[model samples]
Target: MVPQLILVTAFTLYPIVMTHVYSLFEWPGFGPLDRFVGLRNYTRILADELFWNAFQKSFIFMAGTVALQLPLALLIAILLNSERLYGRNVYRTLFFIPVVTTSAVIGIVMRSIFASHDGLVNNGLQLLGLIDRPIRWLAQGDTAMIALILVASWKWLGIKMIMWLAGLQSLPVELYDAAKVDGASFWQTFRHITVPLLVPVGVVVLLFSMVDALTAFDLIFTMTEGGPGFATEFMELYIYRYAFTSFAGGLPQLGYASAAGVFFGVTVFLISLVLSLLARRASQVRR
Candidate 1:
């Protein structure tokens, strides 16, 4: 426990504390940190329309992930958990493969898969006569965001599925037996017993999915570069753009970026706190 605490303090707490401290200064990420701006950076962040736009987009991504990704994963998990299914292990392995792969590498592969005209998806769609011409998935703002969401859903589906599978596996077998004795249909058993029993795990998955959506940067960066004109520019990309990407010899806005990071972190913390309380309540209700 001592070694773990030391590691946490050195790696996680240290960076977070330094991020908050950096937010108070007008540092250019290097050389000097003499200038102090206090709350000016935070104020500037609040006033920045681009930040607000990215905030909205971040929530949009979060909503999409929660609505689409989780359900799909849950369905897959339920299917894989069925005792009647043959080769369930093989299916689980195939699905979980993407979750373990590096997001950047997946993004690179997705870039080619979604490319215009000759791209795999487009070509397949064309062959199927779904459209007369190929859709430019990454060349447009709305479509790029949609593509990002779809890719993210596919990439993360396995993780949430595994979480759901774990929860499903932990459910009391006697409950199912009683449901069977009561002549309850599969849907009835699922709705009355399974759903309520899984609420705690669902809450955990929800929190993680939301945080992942909020901080998703590398894949979007590697794939879209925040382009088709800021279409897929999420909060993470917003911070990276300011912190790392510079234009015309301008210094990086390290202070401003740190402020944004702190803001996002606080937002995540608050949401997680609420969700955690809800999870506790859910567990209480179940018991």
Candidate 2:
């Protein structure tokens, strides 16, 4: 037990400590600690316009993921769970494909689809007379963010759907039968029986979605690279730019990047904590 505890601390605590420690210095991930900047790094993050833009954009991303993904996933899972539904396994496998694939590969395909000129989407839209000119999806500010949200939701919806489906499948058949015996309408049974039993799984999925939304980096980084002149700059991309992008000729401000990372980590922590408390309340209510 002690050895396992040690392993957990070594893996998790070490990285966290290092991240916080590194945030204090503008260490360029190299030879020496150039300077102890203290809170200067944090101040820079607050002053940075791009940082603020990314911060606000993250909320948009989070809202979009939750609004569009989870409900759609729940709907799909319910449909799939229906006794009359056919070809359920085939549909499940198809939906799960994107989640199983690497984000990098998905990004490549999405980039092509979203290309400004002669891309599949634009071409199809033009053919249908929806737009006279090809809309620059990844290049436009709102469109770029929307595209990322759509793609991210598409990839993750299946995961949530599968979880909800499992919960639905595992429900006590007796409870449902009793509801039917009592002349409960389909909606009533669903509301009184299904929802209460499913609260635990819903809580789990909510926690996961909150974390996933907050920490979403790979999909945004790959699809948009926070591009089109910082229009879609996410926190991760902002950190990457500060840390890696050579500025004023050669010097890179890696310490600033660590500060940005700290901000992101803090935000995620807060969101997770709030959701956890909310989930507990929700579970208790269902009880």
Candidate 3:
């Protein structure tokens, strides 16, 4: 227990504390933390239009992924949960393959698939007579965002389905048996018995999905790199841009990036706290 505690402090707690401390300075990545700017970094971040844009994009991505993934994953889980379903395990493994695959690799492959000319999607659409001209999927702002959301959703869909499956399997067979005996139809059993019973687990899954969506970086970065005039730039990409890349022909602003990181971390913490409270209240109500 002591070793585990020491490791946590050394890795997780230490980095977080240093990040907060770095947020107060005007230091670049390599130099000494001589400049003491106090909360100026935070103030500048709050005032920056780009920062707000990134925040809005992040929020949209989180909402879109959660909205699109959860219900679909739940439905798939329910279907796969049925005992009569043949080759369900194979289907589950196929779905989960995307989850295990590297995000960067997936991003690169998906980018090619959605490329403007002679891409898989464009060729298919042309073959089906859907569009006379190829559409630049990642070159336009709206389409780029839509594509990012969809790819992100697809990448994470399997894990959420697995989580839902776990919750479904944990349900007592007795309630389902009684529902069958009472002549409750499939939809009725699902609505009355399954949905209500799965609320607690659903809350947990929702929280996980929210956090995952908020912190998504690798796939988006590899695919779009926040291009097309910052259309797909989320919070993580925003921080990376300031922290690593030279913005506006200037040096990388580590202090400002740290401030953004701290702010984003706090926002994520608050959201998690709210969801946890909701989960607790839900369980209480269930009892």
Candidate 4:
């Protein structure tokens, strides 16, 4: 615990303090933090239309991840965990391959695969007569948003599946045995036993999924670069661009970026804290 505390203080606490301190100044990621314009960065961030838009998009992405990805992962996990399944290990490995692969590489590869004219997506759709013409997936805002969600869901699918698998495996066999003896149907057993017991795991999964969706950056950066109009822009990319990319009209805004980072970080932390308390309450109720 001593060593872990030291590491946390050095890495997490130190960075957070520095970020807040930097947010109070007009620093250009360089030598002097001379200009001390307190709270201006936060004010500007709140007033910025782009910031709000990006924040909204983050919520949309988060919602999509929880609503779409979690259920699919749970379903896949249940199927793979079934005792009657053959070669389940092979299936699990194949499903989990994306989690281990580099997200940037996957994004770059997926971009080409979804390209309009000659891409595999378009080709396949045409082959199946799904559409009369090629669709520019990354060129449109709505389609780009969908692509972002799909890529994110696909990348984390294996991880969430594994988490669910662990929870399912930990469930006591006697419950199922008793259910079987009572002549309970599979769905009835799952609803009354499996679902109720997995509440704690569900809470953990919810927390992780929210954090991952909010902080999604690498694949998004490589895939669209927030293009096709700022439609796919997320808060993480928003902060990175301000911190790194200098505009022709303005200098690089390290302070502004730091403010945005702190703002979102606080928001996420509050949400997580609330969820954690709820999870605790859930555990108590279960007991």
Candidate 5:
């Protein structure tokens, strides 16, 4: 416990504290931290159109991934949880393979797969007479975001499925037996028994999925670098760009970036808090 506390303090709490402290200054990554413009960075971030655009994109990504991924993962998990399913373990392993794969590798591979010229998607679409010419999937703003969402949802689907599987497996076998004895149809049993029982786990899964979608950086960065005119630039990437990379041939704005980071962090925290409240209310109602 002492070692764990030490590690948490050193890695998490310290960084968070320092980030807040740095947000008051206008310092670059190095040199003096002399310029102290308290609250100015926060005000600037609020006024920045690019920052707002990135915020909107982040929410879009979050909404898209959660909408697409969770339902599909839940269905797959239910299927895999079935005792009658053949080679269920093999299927589980196959689904989970993508979850363990490196995000960078997935991003790079997906970029090639979605490329305009002779890419797998374009070629397949053309062969199926869906289109006569290759579509620039990553070269357009709207399509680029769609591609990011699809790839992100695919990559994280397995982990959510696994979470759902755990919840499903933990359900009381006696309730299922009674449902079977009472001649409840699959849909009826699922709706009345399974769905109610899964609320707690569903809350957890939803929280994780939302956070993952919001904080997604490595995959999007490696694949698109927020390119095609910043179409796919999410909040995390926006922070990274200001924190590390030089903008307009200027020095890295570490202080301003820290302010953005703090703002984003607060937004995520508020969302999580609301979700937790809803989860608590849900549990009380279930009781």
Candidate 6:
């Protein structure tokens, strides 16, 4: 147990410790660790307007995801939980295919599909006479954000559906029977029974989406790189740009990037803590 604990601590905490140490220095991430810059990197991050924009984008993504994603999952879960549904196993497997696929591949697919003027989405819209010309879905600001939100929701909804299905199934049957015996209507039973019982599942899904939004990198990286004028710029993508891009002294800002990463991590951590508290409060209120 002691040896296992030591390994776990080393594997997890070591990188974080190093990130903190590196953040205090002006290193290029490849060369020798340089002299301490004290809190310069952190201060720079604090002053960077781009960083704040990314942070705002992350929250927007979070709101869009939780608003649309989980309810869709729950609706599907309810449908899937119905005993009348045929071939439930087949439907479950089909939906979960996206969840099992490689995220990079998914990002690539999304990028292509949402391409401007020539992509499948635009082509379909043109066919439907929705627009005279191809709208640049990924190149525009509000629409680009909406595209990411939809893609993120689509890619993750299936897993949440399965989770909610499990939660629904685990719910004891007697509760429903009693509700029906009390002459409760379908809506009444659903409002009273289903909602109350599924609070835990909601909390879990909210936390999952929150962290995913906070640290979203691959999708945004592959999709936009926070581009078309930083409209869709997210925190993780912003850090990558700062650390790697050669935009005239942009590259080799390792200390600043690490500071940004630590700031993002701490921000997400505190948000998650607040959500945990909110979930607890909600559960208590329901009780």
Which is the leading candidate under lDDT? 3
Query: Candidate 5: where is the Cα deviation over 4 Å?
Result: 1-6
Of 3 and 6, the candidate ahead on TM-score is 3
Q: Give the TM-score of candidate 3.
A: 0.96
- C-alpha lDDT values of all predictions: 0.90, 0.85, 0.94, 0.91, 0.93, 0.85
Model 2: per-residue lDDT, tens digit, 135-171?
Answer: 9999888899888888999988889999889889988
Q: Can you tell me which runs of candidate 2 are displaced by over 4 Å?
A: 1-11, 247-249
Worst 10 residues of 3 by lDDT: 245-254
Q: How many angstroms is residue 144 displaced in model 5 relative to the true structure, after the best TM-score fit?
A: 0.7
Worst 10 residues of 1 by lDDT: 240-249
RMSD per model, one decimal: 1.6, 2.4, 1.4, 1.8, 1.5, 2.1
Cα error of candidate 3 at position 197, Å: 1.2
Please give, for residues 30-64, the per-residue lDDT of candidate 6 as tens digits. Answer: 76786799999999888989889988988998899
TM-score of each: 0.95, 0.90, 0.96, 0.95, 0.95, 0.91
Could you give candidate 4's per-residue lDDT for residues 1-287 as a string of tens digits?
Answer: 99999999999999989999999998889889899999999999999999999999999989987898899999999999998899999999999999999999989999998898799988999999999989899999989888888888988999999999999999999989999999999899989998999898889889989998898899999999988778988999899989988851477889999999999999999999988988888778878
> Model 6 reaches what TM-score against the true structure?
0.91
Regions of candidate 3 where Cα sits further than 4 Å from its true position = 1-6
- The residue-by-residue lDDT of candidate 5 on 83-199, one tens digit each, is 999999999999888889999999999999999999999999999999998999999999889999999998999999999999899899999999999999999999999999999
Candidate 6: list runs displaced more than 4 Å: 1-7, 248-250, 277-287
Residue 69 displacement (Å), model 6: 0.3
Error of 2 at 269 (Å): 1.1
Cα lDDT, model 1, residue 71: 88
- lDDT score of residue 154 within candidate 6: 86
